[model samples]
Structure formats: C-alpha cells, structure tokens
Target: MDSLLSVCDIKEDVSYIIDLAIKIKAGEIEDMPLEGKTLAMIFQKSSTRTRVSFDVGMYQLGGRAIFLSSNDLQMGRGEPISDTAKVLSRFVDGIMIRAIEHEDVVELAKYSNVPVISGLTNLEHPCQALADMLTIKEHFGSFKGKKICFVGDGNNVCNSLLLIAPLLGMDMSVACPEGYEPDENILKISKNFAKDNNTEITISSDINIALDNVDIVYTDVWVSMGDEAEKAKRLKDLKPYQVNKELMDIANDDAIFMHCLPAVRGQEVSADVIDGPQSVIYDEAENRLHAQKAILYHYLK
Candidate 1:
C-alpha cells in the first residue's frame, strides 16, 4: 500500500495485515522486517496509544522512530505540508502523522515519496480501526456474518469502522444523535461495499435498534480532540446513548464490549461495562502494537 490515509487504501490487504498481526503477537515472526529503517512520526495532535505503539513497534522491528511534535518542526512555523513532506521523505523511511485536519495528512501523502500512515485525523482513524478488527477477529474467529454496533458520537472511529466492516464482510450499525451522524460520503461508500459483501450498514438515532443482536458493542469518547467547547452540550445530547448495562443488555448475550481507549468511565461507557468481564478493551489496546507492526511491515519491509 502507498499510504493508509483511509480504509479504502487497505481494502484488499486487511486480512493479510490482521493475520500478520496475529503471528507477530504469537512470536511466530522474529526477524526484524524494518531493520535499519527510520520512521518519522509527526504529531500535530497528542496521543497515548498512537505515539507509544508506533515507537515501540518500530523498535521491536529493529528500526527506530523519531517523535516530532508540532513545535519541533518548521511545519509548525507555517511551512507548507508539501514542503514538509518532501523534506521528511528525504530523511525518513516513512511518515506517520496525527493531525487535526484530514487534508493535512492527505497533502503529506500526496507529496511524500515514502509510505505515509495516518496516525489519526479528524475524519478517520484507520490504524485504530485495524487494531479493532484484530481484536474482533481474536474474539470471534471471523468477520463474516458478524454485526458491530457503534454507540455515541459518529466520529472518526465510527467513520473508519464504517469504511472497514462492510469490506471485510461484516455488518455495522451506528447510533448517534441527528446532527452527529457519520459523514454522508463515507456512508455512501460503505453502502456499496456492504451490497457486494452481503452485509448491512445502518445509521439511526435509536441505540436499541442499533445494538439489536450485534456481536460487538463499541463506543468512543463523546467529545473528541478539538471539541472541548462542545463537551457540555455533547454530554447532554449523547447521555442517552452511553454504553451501560442497560444498553449492553440490548445486544446479544455473548456480545463483547470494546472501546478505542482513554475512555471516560461515566461518559461514553460505564465503569462496569468497560471493566466488566465482557470487556476486551485491554486486549484491544494491546493489539495496537501488533496491528501497527503489521502495517509498518507491509509498507516499510
């Protein structure tokens, strides 16, 4: 893959990456696929999982990762993204950017000669979606015929899941408030993939309907980065959609709970549900390392 700006870029290689992640986790592959390679991680937005996972993942691959915050680069001083991408391409083997605007990462990828990975963006978090898929595959053994329900704000995570689930032969339902629904363009593309995969994609304001008989119940923080001003209003609007015991009961009996991480206990998900027996949040978090290792290996190897 040239770059993973969105799930569409990795549509044909999702399963391969997942399988490779499983092997990496199982210690079946010991060779350093990324030996001597250097990955430049540009972060306009700070993160816990994204930063640490890629740093450790590159290290584990016998390579190195350089962390560059917004203040650490000329891009922070108003340099054009294309210029930054070109300069970085000449120095690093690859580039991973976590930015506030999706367009910035797109520009970086368009100009960079090496592979560019979207660490996270306002529109989509493709790496998290990959890790999430790995977690689901571990729990259920397959993606085909499975259903996943996302509750709360239809944010970047929801958009990425919508892009990926149907392509992998799984149904996805998104529950969000009226004005908080996922991007219409992404929904349209997901619908086409769903049609060919024999899976369904649904978006609605009703949480109960979305969770009905679903295999996985997923949620993320209602107020994501750059939306602190909307926190109070978002909490009020999304309060009814929180993934609590009552909401979990609406799903299948054996349905597992999943969160992307850094969850607010009483907000997007309840303490009981996130820490409960059915919760696979930790496994999901750990898979970020393995999943990203596979991604780096795919492009940098």
Candidate 2:
C-alpha cells in the first residue's frame, strides 16, 4: 500500500501486521526492519500515544523519527500541503500525519513519493484500530465470530472499528445518542462488508442492548480534540453511555473493557471501571507502539 489513510488500505495485511506486532511485543523478532531509514511525523493535533509510540517505534526499529508539530513546519502557516509533501518525501522514508482534516492526509499521500500513514484524522484512525484488533486478538485467540460493542459518540475511532470488525469476521455494535451517530457513509460501507462476511453490524441508542453478550466493550471520549466547544452538550448527551461498573456488568463476564485513552475518568468512563481489573487500557496503549512498528515496517521495508 502506498498509504494507510484508512483500514481499507490495509485490509489484506491486517492479520499479518497484527501477528507481527504480537511477535515484536514478545521480543521474538529483533531485526531492525526500518534500519537506516527516517520517518517524518507531522502532527497537526497534539497527541500522547501517537507521538510517543511512533517516535519510540522508529528507534526500536533502528531508525530515526523527527517530530514536526504544526508550529515546526511551514505548513503551520499557509504553505500548500502538496509542496510540503513533496519536500518531505525527498528527505524521509515515510511520513505519518496526525491531523484534524482527513483530506490533509489524503493530499499528502497523493503528492508524496514515500508512503504516508494516517496517525489520526477526523474521519478515521486506522493505526489505533490496528492496535485494537491486536489487543482483542491477544485477549480472545481469534477474530472469527467475536463481538465488539462501542458506546459513545460514533467518531473517528468508531468509524475505524466499523470498517475493520466486519472485514475480520467480527460483529460490532455502535451505540450513541440519536444525533451523534457515526458517518452515514461509513455505516453503509460497514453494512455491506458485514453482509458479505456474514457478520452483523448494529447501531442503536440503547447502550444495554449493545453491550449484551459482546466479547469487547469499547468507548472513547464524548468530546474529541476539535469538539471542545461542544463539551457541555456532549457531556449531557453522552452521560447515559458512560462505561461504568453497572454497564460493565451488563456485558459478558469475561468481556474486556477498552478505550483509546486520555480518557476522562468521570466522563467517558468511571475512575473505578477504568482502573478496574477488567480494563485493558494500558495494554491497549502499549500495543500502539508494536502495531505502529509493524505498520512502519510494512511501508518502509
């Protein structure tokens, strides 16, 4: 793949990368696949996991990563994305962008000679979904017939999961407030994929129904980075969907709780539940390193 702007770009390679991440995490593979290469990490949005994971991942692969925040690049001002992409392609083996606009990543990929990875965007977060799949596979043994339920605003992370779960023969349910549902285009695409894979995709406002009998209970913050102004409204709308102990009780006894973190303990999830035994948030966070390493290896190698 020339770029990983969406899960669709890595569909055939997902399992391979997830398996590779497992091996990397276990230290079974030590060769530096990206040795002597350099990765340009452009961040239009601030990050904790995405920043640390890719930087450290490149180091572990015996390469270098340059951290370029919005303020660090000419693109921060008014430089055209195409010009920046072309310039960076000459210097770096690969480029990874965490930006607010999905189109920015698309434009970078379109213009760059090197492979481009979408670290995150408003529409989808492919890398996070890859790590999530790895974490789920680690917990469950396989993806076939597994069930995952997402509770909260159906945002970028939700969109990525909707694309991936059906492709891997796993069923997924998304529960959100009426007006806060996932992108309609993504839902339609996921539905088609589910039909072909013989998996189910359901969207509902009833959180209880979504959690019932699922193997994984997942959630994300109600207000994402660009949605800070809507915080109060989102908090009010999403309060009922919080992944507290009572909600967790509704899921299967062995169901794992997951969040793409920087979680608001009292908002998206309760402090007790996030810190609880069933929560795999930390492991999930760490897998970001391994999963991204695998992705970089795929593009850079």
Best by TM-score: 1
Tens-digit per-residue lDDT, 2-105, candidate 2: 89999989878878989989988888886787789999999999999999999999999999999999999999999999999999999999999999999899
**CA lDDT of every candidate:** 0.93, 0.93
**Candidate 2: worst-modelled 10 consecutive residues by lDDT:** 25-34
Q: What value of lDDT does candidate 2 attain over all alpha carbons?
A: 0.93
Superposed model 1: Cα runs more than 4 Å off: none
lDDT of 1: 0.93
Instruction: For candidate 2, report its TM-score.
Output: 0.98
For model 1, give the RMSD to the true fold: 0.9
Clashing pairs in 2: none
